[model samples]
Target: MAADPGPTHPPQHPVLVVGGPTASGKSGLALALADRADGVVINADSMQVYADLRVITARPSPADEAAAPHALYGIVPASMRMSAARWRQRALAEIDAAHAAGRLPIVVGGTGLYLRSLMQGLSDIPDIPADVRQAAMDLQAAIGSPALHARLASIDPVTAARLHPTDSQRLIRAWEVMQATGRPISAWQADPPRDVPAHLSFTTLVVEPPRAVLYARCDRRFLAMLEQGAEQEVAALLGQKLDPALPAMKALGVPEIAALIEGRMDRATATATAQQLTRNYAKRQMTWFRNQMPAALRLDAMELASGTAFTKFYDRIMADMTKNITKMG
Candidate 1:
């Protein structure tokens, strides 16, 4: 008999991460990879987690969902807020389930915070009292985020300096922590011994396309969304009368579309406004990915547009994974 050969690749599967700005085709890449690897597509986008405003949020269509196993998309109610800590917990569990099933876990999204929390672990901040939380929200609504940011700067200059003045959600959160715990959120973050998982290895693929291409895609996608009943989706979501501060209410197209529904803006104005916002958001996402994931493998968005490039990309990933496992052994 001929000499026996070793198994083709390593037995353990590394967790795969597909990350990029919105409309960069990361989702399509993820779907293709998942189909090939028998992997599960886990939601990492914060906006896509909401059960409401799916169309405006540009969540996976019914056909896309049916094409592969997906986890953690559209699971949270719009009325409640989801923290990165909560999302990390759920994501870790989903990853474990995928591994146990002998499938790759593809953590896919552009939410840098959620991905960071998953990799580095969250700060040890205690829960704020409901009254304290409500008070912070109320104060921001009354005085606006810039004003609240000024207040936070006095209490926690380090954290304040890091946040944008107009970022209402984080500004309110910082104030709530200070009021509830009498400690700066930044101080808690400096505490040692975080809860990072040691067992799993992660391989991240970041999609970076030319700015012109990405911006064009963002604009085109939003228009397609409008034609596909985004207006109705926004109307239904607004009908719920959820708090304006809720994350879902602030998703890329929701507020703009809500304005249209309420006669605050005409349809054309609303569409144009939403497209601009999406482009701005995509730019921010690109910046975040570039700054944060320095070690990730980068794929040009145009590269994934063709079938040949996708096959080549897949082979490159497999080759990299094999090299990593070989080094480990």
Candidate 2:
């Protein structure tokens, strides 16, 4: 018999992550996988980590969370800072443990960078000093976002071009780095970690619906949230006094949600604003994934409503992954 050609390089790591816009049924999908008790669910969403404002953030319900072997959600207090580096570290650790036990690590969330850091590595930046942090925050409070972006422009024009004037976190971080270390913020971002070739073989799926459909969905979903005690959740979140700059607070509908809660905007206004913001964000996500993940296994998924829909989705994904893994092996 003729000798069979063996595979050359081994495949990358094995991790299944489900990503989509808010209310896109990611959590339910993770939970369904866990129903078999053959998998562990870890959060990749940035907002779900904050413990204080769980309900408003649309975090996994306690029942769903209990139904699965969940990790990395509702652990961090809103007062503390959690970065992509930190989340990646935690996810890798959980992924390694789950794989060792022969369980699938069903990672799901909406945050793009958290997934990026897991697949690509993150820059190993040391923590900023408290004084430096306070100084930057104070400057932000004193001057304004425009002033902060101007300073970033002066320090690192390349970075400034990519950042918006109102991007509070990026603007403040750039200014903080420039002032504290006397170097451009962009300098520190030069050596972010690249591949996780040795850790696991994996497949990535990006859920991209058409712009009009996603916008309509976003509108319906936000209105539904209001009917389902979203106001109550917002009231709870208000008690946290979390920094407005926290990534959670910047979720698509969050500002408008907050506005409605605080009486600055009515429900109608909040609904309209949320729909617009979400639509814009969905388009941005689609663009990023389309351009950056052309090689990814793109799955054309509509609104994933029930836990079952997610199960079928991943069954398809894992089957494809297994085929590739076997070929590579």
Candidate with the greatest lDDT versus the true structure: 1
lDDT of 2 by residue, 174-266 (tens): 888777777776776687565554547666666666667767876787777777787776666667887776666665567788898888999
Worst 10 residues of 1 by lDDT: 6-15
Candidate 2's TM-score reads 0.82
Clashing pairs in 1: none
The per-model lDDT (C-alpha) reads 0.87, 0.73
- Evaluated at residue 324, the lDDT of candidate 2 is 61
TM agreement with the true structure for every prediction: 0.91, 0.82
